[model samples]
Target: MNEVLVSEKLVVRVPCAVIEYNGKVLAGQRSAALSFPLKWEFPGGKAEKNESDEDALYREIKEELDVDIEIIQKLPVTSKDQGWREIILVPFICRLKTLQITLTEHEQILWLGPEELSSLDWTEADLNVIENYYEYLSVKK
Candidate 1:
């Protein structure tokens, strides 16, 4: 007989920004020093304990991109399970307060239209979020 142990997943809340400027969405390429390096993702970070999603996003955008953002509305949520953890991703539609972006944790950034969103290899969760955004657009249009 073999003994098996089961454990519950550790869920982490991550606040994400789907920032639009001049008809393009902001995407960041992960830094080489980070997990999933070089994969493109919307700018955001994990929420601290007791932090609201919006506040986490605001602080993350400021800290990571060196730009302030005004969140417009909530977008779709995406969830995924990694071997070590489970992620709950909440994305918000946002507008940039400044035109300039200074990245601290990303190698580079791109401004792309919906049609061009697939040009880069995105993180698994982000790819799902993009699909939801596309569906939202198709329904809206």
Candidate 2:
């Protein structure tokens, strides 16, 4: 007989910004130093214990991009299971407080139309976020 061990996976909550400017959305490419290097994702980070999602997003965007943003609305949440852990991405539609950006962690960033978003290699969770955002846009129009 074989023995099997099962345990609950860790869950991390991340608040992400879907920043838009002039009808284009912003995405950042993960630097080689990050876990998912080279994959594109929205700008944000994991929420620290006891921190609210909005506060976490503000702090993360400031730290990562060195810019401020006005969060407009919240989109449907997306999640992914990576075997070792599960990530729940809480996406917020936002606009930059300023046009200038200074990257701290990402290799680079791109501003792209919605149709062009699919061209980039996105993290699995972010793909779902894109789909939800698209649906929200379609319904809004």
Record all residue pairs in model 2 with backbone atoms less than 3 Å apart, i.e. clashing. Answer: none
How does each model score on TM-score? Answer: 0.92, 0.94
Clashing pairs in 1: none
lDDT of 2 by residue, 1-141 (tens): 999898889999999999999999999999988888999999999999999999999999999999999999999999999998999999999999977899999999999999999999999999999999999899989
Clashes of each: 0, 0
lDDT string, candidate 1, 58-122, tens digits? 99999999999999878888998997799889998899998789889999999999899999999
Clashes of 2: 0
